[model samples]
Target: MARRGKKKGRPVSGWLVFDKPVGMGSTEAVSKIKWLFQAEKAGHAGTLDPLASGMLPIALGEATKTVPYVQDGAKVYRFTVAWGEERSTDDLEGPVTKTSDKRPGEAEIRALLPNYTGVIMQTPPQFSAIKIAGERAYDLAREGETVDIPAREVEIGRLELIETTPEGNSIFEIECGKGTYVRSLARDLGRDLGCYGHIATLRRTEVFPFTADDLVPLDALEAAAPKREEAAPEGGRPFAAQGERFVALDAFLLDTGEALDCLPQVAITDDAAAKLRLGNPIILRGRDAPVQADEACATARGKLVAIGEIEAGMFKPKRVFAG
Candidate 1:
């Protein structure tokens, strides 16, 4: 779909997934891409901390509206935990406040991981984006206040100890539902093995079809501005032509598990174009009135443009797809 304009604030719509590198937070990565593309509308589906790297999905233009659905997809990660060291942040970025003389066995460690699978409650580390009262939990902790973060339910479908070392550290690959904290799992694994532990390394391997293989190196984005522009045909997106990537908006919406297909596609009737241009919500008619209302949906797809629902019945122009 073609973007609605050459004016300011309109963004080219599509999905841009990157192999984020360690030490760059998800927001920073998204910001870099936004600046490179010169896009005003962009945001990431999930947050990967500065200490970790891997598949980071940045939604641009209309795709940004689909963040909740995309970010909620199951995630997989490969990580390493250092034994004998406990950090306040549950990662290397934290201060090492504890140590252990005892080493943990691999046999004992495997037994504890299963207990974490399925449903469990977790307290956010003092260093997290969760809010406590009016302030972010991490901010409160940074101020030296004791952070009594609340425990909330999260699901861990699979967390296997991929490997281990005599150094007391362990490597793991995890598949978990949204909101699961791998850092906490690493820390708890350390505890279960009778030693303190912290996450020494982490890399997200997958978020749906996007994987580590598709990720661009963090160093690539950090290079001094290149004189040549990397033009993305669909959005007129200009960024360094490294491993940067994109997925069409139509495919993005249809692929979402949401049952958008159930709704009938209504033609932009001559009477409707003005309203559509004004960005008003309108119900589409199907042979079955009840079904139309029940599946209330809207989409406008053409040469380089695809706009979908802003809400139930409301349609907004999303992106202008390049041919």
Candidate 2:
């Protein structure tokens, strides 16, 4: 008897701006979407904690290749800092380890905002995903082992106090570059104000090119999946059809090129696209001005072909995408 072929899922491609609800891990969210779409591959651009919510960019198939671009993009978050209590995880999920009676006034909080703005050093929470010595910090923390996370410099483009509750909780919105941890900021702000704090509620409003408006709630996506019986065609097996019309999964997929919107783009000829796809460098035409940035996205006939570098009139393909 001949060996059987391996089972495969749909070759779905593009980005899904998942509005990750609280209590759902980033990996869990990705798995749910993957199962719903039956996509061949899926991954998230950034990891959002279970205690945190919003704007988790899910990339499928070719979109996974553009994750780095989206990950490197700036992010905006709105979070609440509950003054007077500090937790082991720096968020509500952790046990309270310290508490303070002091709560800063609205004026006091405003005065201290400047200190956190711009480049600053921050130590990540012990119960975090950051690895130390090939082990996750959270694992060590959970095991009651001392996990010393080092402080690193992160850029905060903007930080503003959005609101203050009568009960001592302060809401804030921050715009920062990649690697900036909101948990650390909340912890540091409390320390700075002489009032210990932990994040009560957290939500990411934007990630670079994507905003809150782009997010699709998990419930919405699940409801959109075609019913098994409805998806079956005459004389065909159930849920075995390919393409968007058959399943409607592609309706949620944003064009893969949209992920690279932050970078400058150049249009190339069909010949150049073919050369780039073959891992070859081609001379850019004079009409297409050289990109000042080191890396640029090259497209032909409105389809992304390669992400490459411009050096001395030569475009060298760093990564080529299947058209």
Best by lDDT: 2
Q: Per-residue alpha-carbon lDDT of model 1 for 1-323, expressed as tens digits?
A: 88786444334556667678777878888987776555557888889999998888887665665576567778999999998888999999989988998777788887787788888998777888888888998888899888888899998888898887666578999988888888888787777777889999998988754565545554555453333344333465333222234222122222221212333444545444555555555454555323223223333442222344434444454422221
lDDT of 2 by residue, 135-162 (tens): 9999999999987789999999999999
**lDDT of each model, Cα atoms only?**
0.66, 0.88
TM-score of 2: 0.92
Candidate 2 residue 88 C-alpha distance from true site, Å: 0.7
In candidate 1, where is summed lDDT lowest over 10 consecutive residues?
Answer: 248-257
Colliding pairs, model 2: none
Error of 2 at 286 (Å): 3.5
